[model samples]
Target: MAGAVQWIAESVQEILQISGLTVQTFLVLCSTFFLACVVFNRSRNLPPYPAGRVPVLGHLLALGRAPQLKLTAWRRQYGDVFTVRMGMKDVVVLNDYTAVKDALVDRSELFASRSPFYYLFDAIFGFGKDIFSASWGPEFRQRKKFATTVLKNLGMRVGRGSIEDNIREEANCLRNRIAENNGQPFDVAHDVAVAVANIICSMTFGKRYDYEDETFRELTKAIATISIELGAGHITAVFPLLRFVPVVNRPIIKALEASSKVKNVMREEISRHRENPRDFLDFCLLELEQQEKVAGLTEENVMYMAQDLFLGGTDTTANTLTWSLLYMTLNPDVQNKVHEELDAVVGKSLPTLSHRSQLPYVNACLMA
Candidate 1:
């Protein structure tokens, strides 16, 4: 296609201009030669990987429309497993589920470590002390062991009941807010984010806030910004060179600053909880104390673990709630069935954790 040629020409032109090299001139020869050396060095170091048309850039160019789908198609053409060079690094794509299972699950020790793409690991993660961000080592194992023990002792059956209760309460709040809008156009993303944040707050801090509350709103915005930015193409985990470049650094800096503010708030909250700890915070504080005394855990590591609990526990549940609400709105019959189940189970009373299991259709609707 003409577009393909245009891209190649542009890429070549940009390389020359960026290097300040004259085309077909002796003065530019050294710079071009240096560029060639860089390219060759990268190629020599690159793993045995499948490549697209472009040199160095590789399949990054052919990734059109839905890149994952395109990659799948490429796998069909190439083989079940293949590699693509994205810039200076190599990406190995395993197409077959069996291959993934054998490599990742069966041979986990070799493949267990997460790639740099884990933003939570790279930034705002206590310089690699938190279990989520900790590199493979004995310390990581110890931290994970502590976390598993704590999670098990949290009385998760009771926690599940608490979570179910919170979900119903949040659903009511969402419905009431939507009703107030009179079906007018409004952004539901904020509501979903707030609901999820509050759930996280409840579990971690044992507190909840109104969606409209200024503090809660700002907190949600910060988390949303951090989440969106990290997942965007702005940050590169695998390639350290890309991270140092000015183009990549700017957004990452902004995201990190925002994330720092969020962390400061979390730190303050942790401080407050430490001073007068209660409920889950008390539990965390007690664990921190034990770790400090027994395991010599750093303060930074403790805070990072708490931070993980706050974000991880909330965001997924909130997104799921938003999706479920959207689906219900598009299917009125399904919504009515949910209402019918709610009425039958709760008998016009606000639904509670005890009523959850009785509302099978409601549960099914939520799952769908």
Candidate 2:
């Protein structure tokens, strides 16, 4: 109770300073707010939360390398549906594909909305506005529709093949970058990251950064740091007052500064696209113009949309490619099989999407 008051006191002081509220009035409002939260939590008949939860951290420390593996083990004991508390939040983990399909496909609307972490999201990007992470409603639906349409036209779907062309070109660039390494202890991770990031970059801004680009390095580093720091600083999500502590606050500030650089680049790309639209940004601007004629779509909306593509697209793809390369290097037998498949199907010719089926083993390895 005292600890809760201490945390709330920080926020209360800010509110008092901002709104000129008396201490008495602030205390009453704070009491009522917490009381309501307690009432609401007790009233809702939530899923079965697993026992053996730690004090404030909950089961967070128990999560292992593969969270799925942990959940699968738990499923045997607790059945397919159960919740685990992370911080103060109860996250219901669905163990099997059936449960996932039921929740996401069969009853999507009930589970579609995202929890708005006021400290985490609202402090950085505005709450519920980006492409994938946005609130699942009309705005998100329209944004997704717009993104897919732009992507489809740019050959994301198997037709005109502009995206594939970009991939092939980037693949060649990656190959040359590797060749430049001269089989020494060159950073495969660095090369693969730039290669993957370049593909998304080409689509988003009609240009790719050099592998040695300082800004690109900072951007990727920031994205990674944000992910790590968020997991570490998750308490801030539940209790925003944690930001008053320097250790917890520093990472958030660094992430925000890094994000600002990425956002600025996106805004610049948007500005450049205004005259002669060419890339995905061009397509988006064109779509936005049409949408504006009809209604809805702000510049801020476009900035977040582009940022989503740049940040989300690059980090995940790069991580996958890096892991794939790492695993292939680690396992000789799998690597040899992949080599044999490539030798048999691809030969001296360049590899393309067309060779996917013929090199089934290699395809499976890459996909896996």
Q: Which of the numbered candidates is closest to the native, going by highest lDDT?
A: 2
- The numbered model that scores best in TM-score is 2
Write down the TM-score for model 2: 0.79
lDDT of each: 0.70, 0.76
Residues 216-333, model 1: lDDT tens digits: 7777667666767766765355444665678767767777877787787677777777654444556667767766432657667767777777666566667787788788889999
Off by over 4 Å in 1: 1-48, 117-121, 158-189, 235-248, 275-277, 292-296, 350-358
TM-score for all models, in order of appearance:
0.76, 0.79
Residue 124 of model 1, lDDT score: 68
Candidate 2 weakest lDDT stretch, 10 residues: 35-44
Give residue 81's error in model 1 in angstroms.
Answer: 1.6
At residue 129, candidate 1 shows an lDDT of: 66
